[model samples]
Each structure stands twice: as structure tokens, then as C-alpha cells.
Target: MINIKRLTTSDADFGARLDALLAFESAQDASVEQTVAAILADVKTRGDAALIEYTRRFDGLRATSMAELELSQNELQAALAGLPADQRQALEAAAERVRSYHERQTLESWQYVDDGADACGTLLGQKVTPLDRVGLYVPGGKASYPSSVLMNAIPARVAGVAELIMVVPTPAGEHNPLVLAAAALAGVDRVFTIGGAQAVAALAYGTQTVPQVDKIVGPGNAYVAAAKRRVFGVVGIDMVAGPSEILVICDGHTEPDWVAMDLFSQAEHDELAQSILICPDAVYIERVAASLEKLLPTMPRQQVIRAALENRGALIEVRDLDEACRIANRIAPEHLELSLADADAWVAKIRHAGAIFIGRYTSESLGDYCAGPNHVLPTSGSARFSSPLGVYDFQKRTSLIRVSPAGSRILGRIAATLAHGEGLPAHARSAEYRVDG
Candidate 1:
């Protein structure tokens, strides 16, 4: 039988226990950090030569030149064409759905004239523009995910990014066709068979062949995470995410089996992944536990699921659904599921969560693949302030200010007063110069 924590809201130590479960050491190991810093410096100095050497040493791909390490558009399209009919259809369908959803999120430039007295006719607004180029790092080999390709690349495309350069490490010169196919479907402009800190460095500081990108997005291992963290200001990056997480708030009306599998969906991601269930019904919690035991043997990734559950999974009995919502806000989980009979009613109660999956039929898996929302969500309680990756992530907003002569004269006195109060003589003089005599 699997051993998972059981908590009750009435217990005096419940808050402490919950805090312990939520705490995770997100700090990178010193050795990993040191190694990443060295690799980043080497790549910055040597450019393509460093990339080639790292590729040979780490990926065991003996490429003579940067050209040899890159994949052509023809190859990407060929990958798409070669997929089995079902896989091709699924990829295309998912891409279209994702594209449609993100199209609505595209930010547009807008301006309006100021109407205040003496400040009238001054134009102020925002100009929204997409990044010129973005680099996407897709994990290759066993962790290769075609879904990630769609989730990251499509938003950049929808935001009108000029170029999307993708880097996936093809260890031993092996490429995952699904990833390439997804790239092609999502309109990625370039692909390089590279990985690890070197790939991130190449993207951050362009090599002979790889053009420098404005931002780097996607997932990778500890080395990749460390590289992104090291080069943050040099280039923008999507969040260095924590492990996958799911918090299911069931109300005893959903099937216990359904609840158990929902928990497994996130737990199967990795050993550090967390799966929790909060319900008002104590007996129903036991039913879900039994369901977990019964279903564990049938999963292909049983070891990972078991480890994640035994390590971080929880079944908590709350005083009521209201208490569950309060706890959910505190957790701010990456994925929140309302598995209640009246799931829609409880949506307003949830103020935090990267994504909210409503109703029993809306499994977290759907949102991962075909549900049309970007699966790249804020993890490790970041949902409290952050949000899911979208077209907005790939767009930049610039404040637009155009002051009329009348408005500048009126605003100049206000600026001069504040600037002089801060003890900046130049700023005061500059503003006073624009003021009327």
C-alpha cells in the first residue's frame, strides 16, 4: 500500500505539516552552478567553437561545423509529413486550437488624448510590439515533448515574432520526429541539434551561425535552468519552473477513481511532482486512497508515480468547501481542479492557480494537450503573482507619451518642483527650461 500524508483542519499541527509539505529547496547545487558559470564563460568567449566542442563532448555528436549541427526547413517539414496519420492529425489539431486561443491574447497598440485641464491634447498610451527573435530549448531524448513545442512556439508566432530558433539536443545524432513535426506545425524558423548550457549560451550570445535571440523559452534539466538563471539580464527567459503540481478540490460527488487518476496525472511527471486532494467528506477521501492503491499497478510509469505520491501527495479533510478554497489560495498550485458537482459555482472562490480545470470530465491531461490553453504554467506557488505563458509573454509594451506645447508648459512646473525636491539641479533646470516665462 502507498503511504501518503493525511491531514485534518481541526488538528493543531495541521498548519505546520502543510507548510512542511509545501517547502522545497529550489536553490541550485553549488557544483551545478559552478559548472554552468564555466560553461557560459567558455561559450561566450569561443562562440561556435565552444558549442561544437560541447556537443561532441556531451551529446557524442561529432559535427565538423555549425552548419552540420543545424536542421533545414525541409527536414522539419519532412518530419511532419512522415508522422502516422493519427499523430499528424493530432499535432495539427492541437496547433490550430492553441493558435486560435492565443490569437485573442495578442496585445495591440492603443493611445488616447489627455482631457485634463491645461494638459488637454497630450497623447498617452502604449505601443505593443513582439520580440524580434526568440530561442526555444526543447529537451530531447527521453524527455522530448511535442506538446511543449506547440505550447512555447505557437505563442511567439501568434505574437508576430520574426524568427523562432529552436535547440534540441540530439544525443548520438538521434532526433524525435514528433518534436520536429510540432516545430514545423508551429512555424519555427530554425532548429539546431544542441542542448545543455552551451545551447542556452549560443542563443543568449549568438555564435557564427546562430543569431542572437531577444528571449529564450522552454524547459530543460538543471544545467539548462542554471544557464538561464546566470544569463537572465543578457536575454529574457521563461520561468525556471519547479516540478509539476496538481491540487484537486473534490466535494465527494466526483467519482473516487476519477479523483485518483487526476492526482496521478501530475505525480507521474516526476518524483518531485506534488498531488493533493482536499475534500469535506472524510469517507470519500478514503475511497480515493483505495482507488490510488488499486490503480497504481496498471500505470506504465508506476515507479515515478509511486515515488511522487509517497513523497509529496496528500489527502486533507477540510471543515467545508469554503475552507478548501482558502487553503487552495494559500497553496497557489500550478493546476487547480474543481471536481465538485457544482464546479462552476466555486470558480469565483479560487483567486490563485495557474490554471483551473472545472468539472469531473475536464481532466488535467486535456489542458496538457488539446484543451487549447498553454500548458506552460507558473509552478511552485508562483501562480500567486505570475501567470500562464501566452502571446503576451512574447510581446513588449512601450509607454507612449506626446506632450503638447500647452501641456508641457503646465506639466513643466509640476516636474520642476518634484525634481528640485530630490536635489537634482539638472532635472530641475531641464524642466524649468520648458516652462513659460
Candidate 2:
């Protein structure tokens, strides 16, 4: 029997216990930071030489030239062709759905001419444009996530990003066919076999061969995360994700096995990932615990699931569904599943969550793969302010302001007043020059 924490809202110390359970300090190792800083500086200084050296030292892949590491258009298509028919169909179908969904999120430029006397026919609005280039990082070796390729690349494509460069480390010159195939389908402009801090550095600061990207997006291991954190201001990055999280609110109507596996789905990611069940029915919670004991024995990643459950998982008994929602909003989990008869009705009660998986049949895994929303979600309580990655993330918006002669006089007077109050003489003079008042 696994040891999962049990809590009840009626307990006097429930709030404090919940706080202890929810705390996850993501502090990076000081040694890792120092090492990342050195690597970044080396890559910036040495260029292709640093890349070639690191690739050989880390991946044990001896490459004479940068050209040798790049995957050609032909190779990408061949990987796609080589896939089993079923795999190919699934990938393509998922890609299409992701593409279709993100198309709706594409932002367009808009302008409006203000006719107010202060405006003097000034045209003011915003211009939305696609990023020039973006770099995507995919983890390689034993872990193969073609789904990540589809999720990250498809959005940039939908947003009209000009060039998409992908970097995946091929250990000992061995590559994952699925990843390359997905890249091909997603229309990635370039592909390189590079990983670790070097890949991030090369993308942030251009080398002789690899081009600098406006933004770098995707997932990686600890070293890669450290590197991304180090080079944040130099280039754009998607969120530095925390462990996968899922908070399931069941109404005792959903199957016990389903609830258990739903918890397991997130827990199986790693030892730190959290899986929680908030239900009003105490008996149903016990049944779900029983389901966990029986079903955990069958899972291939049972050790990991067990560790995650024992360490961070929880089953909470609330007075009612309303109480469960209150706790959920406080936690602000990454994946919030409303496994209730009236899932639709409770949507209004939810104020914070990365992605709301409604109804019993809607698995969080579906949203991770083909459910069409970008699976890249805010984690570790970041859902309180952030959002899922989308086409809008790849598009840049510029404020448009055209001050007419009449508008300049009216606006400059106000600007000069504020600037003078702030003791900015230069600013005041700059605005006063245009102000007729």
C-alpha cells in the first residue's frame, strides 16, 4: 500500500498542512549556474568550434563539420515516410488539429483613426507581426516526444514565424525518427543535432553555421533548463516548466479506476510531479485509493508513480463541491479536471488553472496530445498569472501612434506638465517644442 497524504477541510491545521504540501522550491544548484555561465561565454566566444567540441564531448558524436550535423529536407521527409502507417496518420491528424486550433488564435494588425479634437485625426492602434525566427529544443536519447515537436513548432508555423530551427541531441549519432518526422510535417526550416547549454547558446548568439533565433521554446533536462534561465534576456523563452501537475475534482460519479489512473497519469511523469483528488465523498476517495493499489502493480513506471504519490500526492475530503473548488483555486494547478456531473456549471467557479479538462471522458492526456490546445501550460502555481502557449506567443505587437499637428499640441501640453512635475527638463522641452499651448 502506497502512503499518500490525506487531508480534510475540517482539520484545524489543514491550511498549514496544505501550504507545506504545495511548496516546491525550484532553486537551481549554484555549481550548475556557474557551469552554465561558463558554457554560454565559451560558445559566444568560440562559435562553431565550441559547438563541435561540446557535441563530441557530451554526445560522443564526432562531427568534422556543422553541415554534417544538419538534417536535410530529404532526410526529414524520409523519416516521415519510414513511419508505420498508423503512426504517420496519428501524427498528421494531431498536427492538423493543433494547426486548426492555433489558426483561430492568430492575431491581426488593427488601426483606428481617432477623430476627437485632442487627436486631430491621429491614427492609433497596434501592428501585429510574426517573429522572424524561433529555435525549438527537444530532448533526445531514450525519451522520445514527437508530441512536443507538434505542439511547439505548429504554433510558430500558424503564427507565420519565418524560420523554425530545431535542435535535438542525437546521442552517438542515433536519432529518433519520430521527432524528425514531426519536424518535417511541421515545416521546420532547419534541424541540428546539438543539445545542452551549447545548443541554447548557439541559438541565442549566432555561430558560423547556426543562426540566432528571436526566441527559443520547448523542453529539456536540468542542464538545458539552467542554460535557458541564464540567457533569458538575451533571447525569448517559453516558461521554465516545473513538474507536471494534475488536480482532479471528482463528484463520486466517475469510475474509481478512472480517477486513480488520472492521478497516475501525472504522477508517472516523475517523482516530484503532483497528483491530487478533491472530492466530497469520503467513501469514493477510499475506492480510488483501492484502485491505485490494484492498478499501480500493472504500470511499467510503478516505482516513479509510487514515489510521486508517496511524496506529493493527496486525497482531500471537502464538505461539498464548492469547497473543493475553493481549494483548487488556491492551489492553481497546471491541469484541473472537473470529473463532475455538472462540470459545465462549475466552470464559472474556477478563476485560476492552466487548462480546464471538463467532463469525465476528457483526459488530461488528450490535451497533452491531440485535444488541440497547446500542451505547453503554466506549472507550479504559475497559472495564477500566465497562460498556455499559443500563436499569440509567437507574434509581436507594436503600438501605433501617429500624432497630427493638432493632436501634438493637445498631447504635448499634458506630456510637458507631467515631465516637468517629474523633474525631467529635457523631456519637458522635447514635448514643449511641439505644444502650441
Candidate 3:
């Protein structure tokens, strides 16, 4: 059963328990670092040979060359055909929504600057260029997440990434058809049958077969997360995602069953997944707890939900809506579902969250699919700083600056003065040259 706590108590010591419930900080031990470093070193030295060896050891499959890992067009088509019509339609629809939403996030090159003289206007702008290649990592251990494939690849495609590669682990030497079909829908360029720390290494430091990518994005298990952290300096990453988390802010007016289901939606992800509820009414907490108990047995993933709820789930009673809002902001949850009657009224109060589901009808699952928002979000407490994955993740911005004679003269004195103040004489001299020329 989910732990239920009353908020009416005046005890200050309750803060400690609340902090413990909110804590999702990664436990970085030396072993994780050592293991990841060994994997990286192996890939760096042996290249394709190391990837093959690691694949055999971890993924329980044998593939000597990168050619064996690459999926053929026929294989992708076959996968799509194998899916039921309804499932296929869902994937296609979700892909369209994901692509449409991300297309809006695309940026274009722009310039803005003017000086008095005809040839003196400075050209100050930013160039938005897509990465030459990108890699998407999809976990395949617990279950296949086709949604993840669409969420990661659609945004990259929309951003005009030239080469979009996807990697997933399959022990049976078979790829999940649903995953391949989703990849097809999202226009993924290549699909590889590889996973774990070694796969990340192959992507970061290209092998004979797998091309090195400018950026790597997607969610994975602990080993995969550790690998991303190790390769951070070598290549860009979306985020070192932690466990899944969802927070629900509900009023007594909302149905307890609806709130419970929303909580279960996240809790079913893994035992480390956190599902939290904050409400002013103690009666709501009791009702939601009862609903969870009633619904747990009916769920196919009941064991997972049970373990997750036992480990990281909580139901907190707050003094009022304002306190509930403050608590939600402090936690900075990945998926925040505002189920209050007047959800829009409290939207301004939420300072941090990866994605906000604004009404009772808008559940977190909608955002995970056709809600037109990127499902790949900053997990754990990263919502406090990082943002959801989008087109920006697949593009790099470069500043463009052109100084004309008159423009340089107008700006040079201040630049020289600032450079000189910082003890950079060469910088000051360079600016002075432009002004005097």
C-alpha cells in the first residue's frame, strides 16, 4: 500500500521525511565509474572487435561485423506489416504528432545589427545547424518502448539531422517489430542490434561499421546511464536520466481512481520510479490509497507497480493549495499532472517541471503519446535545471559577428577597455586594429 501522511501536524521534523521522499539523487560509487571506464577503453582500443565481444557477453548474441547488426529495409517493412492495424495506426498517429510538435521548435539563421555608415553595419546573428549524425539508445530488457523510438527520432528528423541511428539490445537475435515499425514511422536512417555500455562507446567513438555521432540521446538502464556520463566530453548527451518520476496535484473534486491510475502509470516503469500525490484534503489521500489497493490486482504489471509504490511512492497532505504548489515546485517532477478544478489558476505557481499536464482530462499518458509534447523529459530532480528533449538537442547554434569600419569604431573602444581591464592585451590590440583600420 502507498504510504499516506497527514499534513495538519505542526512538527518541523516532518521536513526530513519529506526530503527523503523527494530525494532521487544518483548514487555515484567508484564501481560504476570503473566499469564504464573499462568499457570505454575497450571500445577505443579495439573498435568493432570490442563492440562485438561486448554484445556477445551482455546481449547474448553473436555478430562479427557491423553489417550483421544493421537492419535491412525489407526487415523494417516486414516488422511494420506484422503489427496489428490498430497498433500500426497508433504509431503512425503518434509519429505525426511528435514530428509536427518538434517541427515548430526548429530554428533558423538570423542577423540583426545596424551602424550609421553604409558599410559599417555589423552582422550579428546565430546560425542553427543540425548535427551531421546522431544516435538514439533504446532499452530492451524489461520491455520494448516503441514510443521512446518515436520521441527521440522524430525530433532529430524534424531538426534536419542527416544521419539518425538507433541502437537496441535483443538477446534472441531478433528485433521487436513494434520498435522497428516505430523507427520506420519516425524516419530513422539506421537500426542496429546493439545495446549497453559498449553500444554507447561505439556511437561515441565510431567503429568500422557504426558511424560516430555528434550527439547521443534516449533513456537506458544504470549501465547505459553510466556509459553516457563517461562519454559526455567525447559527444553530447540529452541528459543522464535517473528513475522515472510523476507528480499529481489533485483537488478533492477529482476522482480517486483517476488519480491512482495516473500514479500507477509512472510507478509501473520500475521499482525506482517515484509516484507522488500532493493535495490539501486528507480525505482525498485516503480515497486514492484505497483506489490504488483496488486497482493494483487488476493491473498486469501489478508486481512492478507494487514494488515501485512500496519503494518510492508517497501521498502527502498539504495545508492548502499554495503549500501543495510549493511542494511540487521543490520536487521538480518530470511529469506533473495538475488535476485541480482550476488548473490554469495554479499554472503560474509551478516554477519547475519537465512537462505539465494541465487538466483532469489531460493525463501524463497523453503527453507520452499524442499530446504534442516531447515524451523524453528530464527525470529525477533534473527538471529543476534541464529541459525536455526537442529539436534543439539535435541542432547546434553558432554566433556570427562581422564588424565593419564604422561599426568597429563604434564598439571597439568598449571592447578594448573591457579586454584591457581583464589583462588581455592581445585582445585589446586586435579590437584597436579593427577600429583604426
Candidate 4:
């Protein structure tokens, strides 16, 4: 049974409990660390030979050579042709929305001045160049999420990425048609039949077959995440994501059934996924709980949802909406749904959250698929500092400084002084040489 707490009687104590409940501590078991390290070391030492072995062991498939893993253009086209018209149309439409949103996020170079006639300036800008190559790891464990392909690949494409490579595992050495169709719709340059830690290793430190990528993106299971974390120094990664989390703030005006269903959306993702409700009214909580009982039986993924809620979900009655907003900011959830009366008014109070879903009509699922924002978000309380995967992730920025002779002379003394104060004569000498000469 899900626990319910009232904030009125023990305001401070209950608030602290809420904070403890929401905090995402590193709960990784020791075995995961050992396993990940072993896998990474194996890949580093054996290279392609190790990857082939791991692929067979984990994914139950064999790739004797790297060439067998790569997907051909005709194969991708056949996958798209095989999809029903409705599914194909939906994928294309979602890809367009994703493209449009990320296009707006593109940044350009700029130049700025520091002083007057003795002019010192810096080219203060970011070069929105795309990654030469990227790998998108789509999960093939319990189910297939074609939407993950679009969400991960389209941003890279809009950012002008040269090559988009996708890797997914197949149980019977056969890729799902839906996954292939999504790859086709999102303009993935290449597709590969590989997964788990070995796939991440192959992408980070290229094998004889899989090309080395500048960065890797998309969500995966624990082994996949651990592999990404282990290989982070070799290449860039979006985030070391945790399980899915949804924090919904609701009022008495909304229907109970809608609230329960909204919570269930994230809960079904995994057994550790969290679904929280922070509201002021007790009557609304009761109604939502009853509705959850009614709806849980109808869901095909009921077992997953039930375990998630029982383990990590909560319903807390706060003093008022102001307190609710404060708690929400502190939690910094991956997905925040404002199912309140004046959702817009509360937007200003949100200092943290990977993505905000405004109003009753807007669902978190929309953002996961057809919505204009990228779905690759920071999870496990990382919303406090990190951000969603975007066009900027594919690009790197380099700072340029241009100083005239006069500017150099004017700035050299300060540089020398600071360098000398820090007890570094070489640093001082380098600046002194420019002014002296």
C-alpha cells in the first residue's frame, strides 16, 4: 500500500520526510561496479574479439564480423515499407516536431569588446557544429521504443551532425520492424544489431566494425548506464540517467481517474520508477487512490506499475500550493506535470525540473513522442544542475581572444602581478615578454 502523510500536524517533520523520500541516493550494488569494470577492461584489451563474445553472451546473437552488424539502406527502406500507414505517419510527424524545436535552439558566434582605444575583445560564441558520429542505444529488453530513436537522432540531425548511428539488440538475430521504421523516419545514417555494455564499448572505442563516436545518447538499462559511466573519459555522454520519475502537482478541480493514469504512465517504465503527488487537499487524495485501484487492473503492465508505486511512490498533503511548489523545486524531478487550476502562475516558481508539462491537457507522454522538446532528460535528482539532451550537446565551443599591442601592454601588468602573487615566475615572464618586446 502507498503511504500518505499529512503536513498540518507535523509540518517540519513531514517536510523532512518528503525530502528524504524524494532524494535519489546512489544505491548501486557492489556487483554492478565489478561487472561494469570487468566488461570495460575486457573491451579495452580484446577489442572486436571481446565485443563479439559479449554480444553472444548477453544478447543471444552472434556477429562473426563487424560487417554483419551494420544495417544496409535497402534494409531500412524495407522496414519502413513494412510499417502500416498510420504508424509511419505518426513517426514522421513526431520527427518533424522534434526537428523544428531543436532548430530554434541553434546558436551562432559573437564578438565582444573589453576596453576603449586599447581594445581587447573575445569572440564570445558557441559553434553549433554537429558531432562527426554519434551512437543511439535503443532498449530492446521488455519492449521497443521507436520514439527513443527519433528523440535521440533528430536533435543531432537538426544540429548538423554528419553521421547518426543507432545500435539495438535482437533476441532472435532479427531487428523489430518498428525500430527500423523509426530509424528510417529519423534519418539515421547507419544501424547496427548490438547492445549492452559491449555496444557502448564499441561506440566509445571503435572496433574493427563499429565506428568511434564523438558522443553517445539515449536511455538504457543499468548495465548500459554503467558501461556509459565507465567509458565517459574516452568519449562524451549525455547523462548517467536513472529510472523514470514523475512528480505531479494537482488540485481538487481535476478528475481522480486522470491523475491516477498520469502517475501510472511513468510508474510502468520500471520497478524503481517513482510517481509522486503533492497536493493540499485530503479529499482529492482519497479520490485519486480509489481511482488508482480501479485503473491498475486494466493496465497490461500492471505488475511493473504496482511494484514501482509500492516501492517509490508517495502522496503528501502540504500546507498549501506555495509549499507544494517549494517541495517540487527541491525534488527536481525528471518530469513535472502541473495539473493545477492556474498552472501558468506556478511556472515562475519552478527552479528545477528536466521538463515542465503545463495545464491539464498536456501529458508527459506528449513530450516523450510528438511534443517539440527533446525527451532525453536528466534523471535521479540531476535536474538541479544538468539539463536535457539538446542541439548544444552535439557541439563544442572554443573561445578566441584578440588584443592589440596597446591592449596587450595594458593587460600584461595585471597578468604578471597575479602570476607573481601565485608564485609562478614562468607565467609572469610569458606576459612580461609580450609587453617588454
Off by over 4 Å in 4: 1-12, 113-128
Model 2: residues with Cα > 4 Å off, grouped in runs = none
The residue-by-residue lDDT of candidate 4 on 403-432, one tens digit each, is: 767777778888999999999999999999
Query: Quick one: ranking by TM-score, best first?
Result: 1, 2, 3, 4
Each candidate structure's TM-score, on Cα atoms with residue i matched to residue i, is: 0.99, 0.98, 0.95, 0.94
Segments of candidate 3 deviating more than 4 angstroms: 1-10, 116-120
Q: Comparing 2 and 3 by lDDT, which wins? A: 2
Backbone clash pairs for candidate 1 read none
Q: How many residue pairs clash in each candidate?
A: 0, 0, 0, 0
Which of the two candidates, 3 or 4, achieves a greater TM-score against the reference?
A: 3
CA lDDT of each candidate?
Answer: 0.95, 0.94, 0.86, 0.83
lDDT by residue for model 3 (9-116), tens: 245876888787777657777787788889989998899888888888887777777788789778888899899999998888988888888889998999888655
Per-residue lDDT of model 1, residues 212-329, tens digit only: 9999999999999999999999999999999999999999988899999999999999999999999999999999999999999999999999999989999999999999999999
- Worst 10-residue lDDT window, candidate 1: 428-437
Candidate 3 TM-score versus the reference = 0.95
